[model samples]
Target: MTLRNQVLIWIAFFIVLMLALWIFRGILLPFVVGATLAYLLNPLVNQLQKWRFSRGWATAVVLLSVVAIILGLFFMLVPLAGQQVGGLIQRLPGYASDLQELARRWAPELNAWLGPEQAARLEATISDLLGRIVGFAGGITGEILASGWGVITTIGIVVFTPVVAFYILLDWEGMVRGVNNLLPVQYKDEIRGILAEIDSSMAGVIRGQGSVILILAVFYATALSLAGLNFGLAIGLIGGLFSFVPYVGFAIGFLLSMGVAIVQFWPNWWMVAVIFAIYMVGQFLEGNILYPKLVGSSININPVWLMFALLAFSLLFGFVGLLLAVPLAAIGGVLVRYGVRKYKASALYLGENGDKGGDQTAV
Candidate 1:
């Protein structure tokens, strides 16, 4: 095929693939999750292979060990998480009452500053918020129900994901080789270079981000739990997990910790400041220590763009979309860099008149 036709054919193939994915997205959850796992475990599998293990043995060892670890954590923490969630649920009513009482205590000052109408409105808003907090206690369960995932879905993830992952892992090398074999010989080197760049980028992001989040989670959870916040561990875990998307995780964790601290340590009140300080310390450690040491990337992406990718993917593909978004965004970034390099060399950009726009970025 001519080069233009080949390009068109590739574009058409991807379009069809995307359309198929969109159409059957509901059923793709397990496969997506499985593929993500395969990608993550591929490094370990490759390392084991280097140690002279067959691909099968490497995959089996990695998958079995990983599953065991996951199961262990689930069994170990589920009870604790359930206990914490239960306690929080039970105390939510009292927390709501305390908030109302606190609001009433400030009513005099609020009224003086804002006038009766606005003060009353403020009180109503407070009540509404507390009501939602009460609703949130309920919403936690409600949201689960609203998600439409049930026992079967859980089983699907637990069962089929490993099976799919195993096949992918088993054939991972063949898959890569197969794709390379299909590439046009003329562009194979260029494409292989791009794939190498992508693999390097992915490794840095995945392994580094995973370690960073785990470290932050441990730090935040331990600190908050020791500080005696009622739901600190849960809050910290959430914060740490969300940290993958920049400051989002920390902000969320901080807000929850603050709310819980206010509810649990009210009247005394200094505990709230203590909780805030814990988050500040966590943020400091993350910014100054963890990210610098772990995620020292040569090509730094804009946080704004990262946030945009997260939101855009979440909007388009829900949770699974969110899972795919970051890597896709990273890959997109790499592609954009390549496109820019090409554009810089092209007459359209350099101009037929050759305006000499200086050197192009080689990101």
Candidate 2:
């Protein structure tokens, strides 16, 4: 095919793929989840195959192990998380009142520093902002928990996803070969290189960072709860979950922990110090150990771009979009970089002179 024809064909293919995704979005969740699980677990299956096990046995073993782990965690942690969530919601009003009381105590110092009018305004602003924040937090939390439970209770996901994932895992190599066979001969190598890059990015983000998030979540929740910090479990889980975005998780957890610590343990000073110490340790492990060991330099995506992709995808496709956002973002990032490289090498970018110096300058 002519280059233009090839380009048009690919464009049409993408459009149709997107249309299909949109048209069948409601039923795509289980499939997407299954596919993601398969992707993450494929390496384990591969390892087992390397050990001379059949693919089917390897897949079954891996899937069964994962299911056991998930069920164990669900049974152990879900009840506590649920109770904590309920308690947090129920205490929102009391927390608000406490915050306002804390603010009232600061009124004297504020008045002395900035005079009555400004302090009054500042205090009112703080109170209003606090109320708004608390209200929003409560509402969003309830909705999120409800939606999450609804998804968990979904019969299709519970029943069908395993079958989908099992077959996909069993035939993973064959599927890969099939796709490889379809690639145009002329562009096969280049396309394969791009796919490899995408694979690396996806693996780093999903498997590596996923490990990081899970470890951090467990560490934070356990440590904070042990430290007796109010709402520690919730704060830790949130912080750990946000850790995928770099410093965001730390910042959020720190702020929430500190706020709660101050509110709950103001005069103790030492306990507050202890909370700070726990986060410092967690940060140290994440920065020095977990990220270095697991993630390394494989993920080249910018945090800003990742966040934008998440927001955009979530808005466009809801929960399914959220599940797809990171993988798609990785693919998008690889393609964009490839396009840029191609653009820089083209005569159009090189100009009539075909200056190599321009390429260096572009770099």
Candidate 3:
């Protein structure tokens, strides 16, 4: 085939593959997740096998250990989260009252600025806004609890994930070899090089980001708990997990925690200041220590590009898109780098030094 024909064929193949991935994405998530788990656990399984353990035994042990860790975290976090949520729910009414009173005290100053009639209208508008906010919050909570089929579906996914992961881990090497064998022989070396680069990039990003997030969670949770803030653990967990998306975690945790501290300990600026200080310290530590250590040499996606990728993917494919955005971005970066390298070597960009003639004629 001509070079142009080969290029066209390859483009068509990729287009079809992307379309298939988009159409069957829902069914693919579990498999994608399982494959990632297998990849991450492969090293540990190899080490176990090196210790003279049978492959089957090593796979079982590694899978079970992973499952046990997940189960333990669930058991530990659920009750704490439940208690915190329950307490927050119970205090909702009092928080509303306090907020209303605070607003009312500020209304007279509004009256002096806008006159009594306009001020009363402004106050009513504010009250209505507050009511709608509370109603929206209540609606979300109710939907989560009352949507029976949704709850069941979620539970099923949770239960089956580990089972899928276990089998994938057990057969990971065979799977890799099978895939490699299927690649076209002429392109096998290039494909292998790209795959290795992708693997290294993904491992660095996923494992490093995960470790950093865990450390930040512990730091934030401990600091908030020591400061005696209600819902501290929840805030910290949310912050740390979302920290993978740049400043999102810190912004969310800081704002939410500050708002809660203000309402719960009103007129006590000291508590509010302390809460802010704790979040600042957490941010400092993450920037100076955790991120540097964990995410070293990983894809350096700028904040603007990162946010754009998140927004675009989330809009296109919802949660799965959001989860895959960073990896996709990393892959795009790799492709771009390769393209740049090729361009630099190409005749169009090389001027008089172009590979147009034989080596001896290239002055």
Candidate 4:
């Protein structure tokens, strides 16, 4: 194919793929989740294969072991998190009352500092804010569920994800070979090189970052729980999970931990200080130790570019887009660099003499 024709064909293919994803987005969640699982678990299957297991048997064993681990974690953690959530909801009113009393106790100082009129305005504002917080806290779960409950049901995901993962894992090698066979003959080697780069980038960012998130979650959850903060487990897990979004996770975990500590142990002050110290230590460990060791060198995408890609994809394709954003961003980054390299080497970039002459003679 001519260069222009090849470009057109690839563009058309990309457009068609995007159109299909948009059209079938609602039902795509399970498949996307399954594919992601398969990708993550592929290494384990490869390890088993090295031990002389057939592909089918390896896949089955890995999936079963994963299922068992998930079930155990689900049963053990879900109930405790749920209890914490319920207790937090129940205590909102009491927390509000206590906060109000605390504010009132400082009323004299506030009046002396700000004058009666400003202090009165501040008190009224605080009351209104507290009321809004309580109301929002009470309904946030229901609001989230009502908005997202139908996107992918619990039953559908649980039933379909494993089946999709299994078949994909079993046929993984053949599928790779099939795709490789379809590459254009002229650019096959170059395309393969790009694919290799994409694979490396994906493995670095996704797998390495995954390890970072898991470690952070465990650390936060364990530390908070050991510190005896109310709803520590939930706070730690949520913070850890949210760490996928960068600094957002640390902010969320710290704020939630501190908020709970203040409410549960206000007069004592020591416990609140302990919670603050835990978060500080966690942040230090993540920033200085974990991220650098696992993810620093591997990340080629700029943070600003990453955030933009995530926001753009999420807006375009909702949840499925969010799931795909990282991999797609990595692919796009590699392709862009390849394009720039090609461009820089072309005659157009060097006044038509670059390709024919050595670098010393180029414009």
Candidate 5:
């Protein structure tokens, strides 16, 4: 095909692909989860294959290993986590009371500024919010489970994700080669370069950042549990997971843990201080040591831009968009850089009549 025809065909194909994705967006969740699962497990499968195992067997081994680890966690931590969740829900009224009392401590100052009537209304509003927040999570979950179909869909997605992952992992190489072979000859190299960039960015987030998250989770969880904090494991895990978002996770975890501490251990300032110090040290280690050694410059994304992408995508496509935000942002960053480079070297940039070569050579 001619170069112009090839370019046009590629554009048409892209349009079709995007339209198809939109049409089937609602049903894409399980497949998306399965594809992500395969992507995560494929590395382990490849490693075992290199040691002389067949692809099928290697996939089986990896899947089995993953299941074993999950089962172990279930047995070891799930009960405690569940108990903690129940306890927190049950204690919501008490938390509300504590928060209200704490707010009232400052009501006198507010009364001086805004007068007693407004200050009293402000306290009432704060109390109402606290009470509502206690049921906010349960309300959402109840809504999701309100219909029988919702429960069935949830169960189906959980049950079938592994099955889809196993098949994809076994045939991963064939799938890659098939897609590569179908790429237009003119754009294949360019497309391959972009794919490689996406792979590099995903590796930092999925593997390197994943390791950092796990380390932080264990450190914080264990430390908090030792400190006798209520729901320490859950709080620590939440903090570590949030670490995936740079500074936001640590801050959330610290504030949450401290809030619980205030409710559970009020007038005991030492424990709250300890919790604060733990998160501060964790942030310091991540900034100075872990990130540079592991993730380094692999993902060329701005943290603020990433948060915006997450918010926008999640709003547009719900959970799928949220799950995809980071990857899409990374890919978007690559395309932007590509566009800027092309623009800088184009005739329009140097001026239509300017000497394209002489201007470049002078620099």
Candidate 6:
């Protein structure tokens, strides 16, 4: 077969593979999570093997340790999270009253510019907004309770994921070698190079970004707690975790924290000021220290492109799209860089003298 025909066939195969992944995403989630966990832990398992331990033993040790840590965390966090969630629910009515009072006190002055009817209309609008917010909160609470089955299924998946990861880690090297051996000899070196590049890029981005998110979470939680905010721990934890998607953590944390502060201390500008100050300090630390130290220069996706990709993916595939967006963007960035380099080197783009825009070369 001609090189052109081979290229077409390879492209067609990849398109089909991507379609399959998209269609079977629900079934694939556990395997994908397991594979990612294996990738992250493989280095540690390899190090244990170097200490004269057999590969199987090392894999078993790592998997068991990981499982123990996860279970310990679940035990410690679940009760605390449940308590905080319940407390928030209990406080909702008080919060609603505080919000209503603040609005009633402030609305008349702003309404003075307009007639009483306009003011009443403005108050109605505000009431409608508050009602929607309450409805959303109630909806979320109902969903959580309704999702008892989902919670059980999720726990099962989490338990099974690490177990699957252990076997995958153990066989990772052999799997790579087997796939390489199956490739045509003529293209083996090129394929190996591509795979190695992709693997390195994925590993660096995943590990680095994950560490950054954890660090930011700690920073946010500590700062908020120190500022003596209600539900600080919960807000900080959620904010920090969601920070993986660029500024999402900051946006969510800011709005939630500000709302809580306003509700807790009605008409007290000072409390809102304190919350804002805490968030500002946390943001400064994240921008100056945490992200720099953790992610470094690993992911080169620009903010604009990252947001666009995230929105597009989320629209197309919901939560799964959101989860996969950054990794896909990182991979696309790498491929785009390679394409640019190749384009610059090509005779079609570069002149015979290798000077861009000089005399064009005939193909």
Model 1 lDDT per residue over 1-363, tens place: 664796698689868876776677667889988987898899899999999999999999999999999899999987887687677668777877877888899899999999999999999997886687578558655655555468888898999999989999999989998999998798899989888877766765776777889899888888999998888777777678779887778766776687778777876768788898998888888888888788777335678888998888766666666777777777777777877887777777776766674334322
Runs off by more than 4 Å, candidate 2: 113-125, 142-153, 358-363
Residue clash pairs of candidate 3: none
TM-score of each: 0.84, 0.90, 0.79, 0.84, 0.81, 0.80
For model 3, give the 10-residue run with minimal summed lDDT. 140-149
- Per-residue CA lDDT of model 6 for 1-363, tens digit only, reads 774697699689868866876786555556767877897788889899899989899999988898899789789976786677678667756766677777788776867877788888887886676666567657656754553427665875787788779889889889978998899898788767766666666765688788778777777777777877888777788789878777878886776688788877666789789899888988888789877876767677788888888888666654556667787888778777766876778776776567865754432
Best by lDDT: 2
Give the Cα lDDT of each candidate: 0.80, 0.85, 0.75, 0.83, 0.78, 0.76
Q: In model 1, what is the error at residue 34, expressed in angstroms?
A: 1.7
**Which has the better TM-score: candidate 1, or candidate 6?**
1
Q: Candidate 3, 4: how far from true, in Å?
A: 4.4
- Per-residue alpha-carbon lDDT of model 2 for 1-363, expressed as tens digits? 765797798799889987888787768888998998999999999999999999999999999999889889889988988788678667767776786798789889989999999999988886786677578667667655554447554778888889889999999999999999999899899899988998998898889989999999999999999999888898788889878765778986886787678789977989999999999999999999999899887887898999898878777776787778878888888888988998788788897788978868777
Which stretches in model 1 have alpha-carbon errors above 4 Å?
1-14, 86-97, 107-144, 353-363
lDDT of 6 at 131: 68
TM-score of 5: 0.81
lDDT of 6: 0.76
What CA RMSD would you report for each candidate? Answer: 4.1, 2.8, 5.5, 4.1, 4.5, 4.4
Structure candidate 2, residue pairs in collision = none
Residue by residue across 53-142, what tens digits does model 4's lDDT show?
999999999999998999899899889887887787687678778777887898999999999999999989867876876686666566
Order by TM-score, highest first = 2, 4, 1, 5, 6, 3
lDDT of 3 by residue, 1-363 (tens): 665796698789868866776786555556666666776788899999999988889989998898789789889887897687567655656666667788688788988999999988987875675566456546645754553326555665576667787888777778999999998899799889878877767876677777888888888877887888888877677678778888878876776577678787778989999999998888888888877777776676677887888888756655556667787777766766766776677766565557545454554
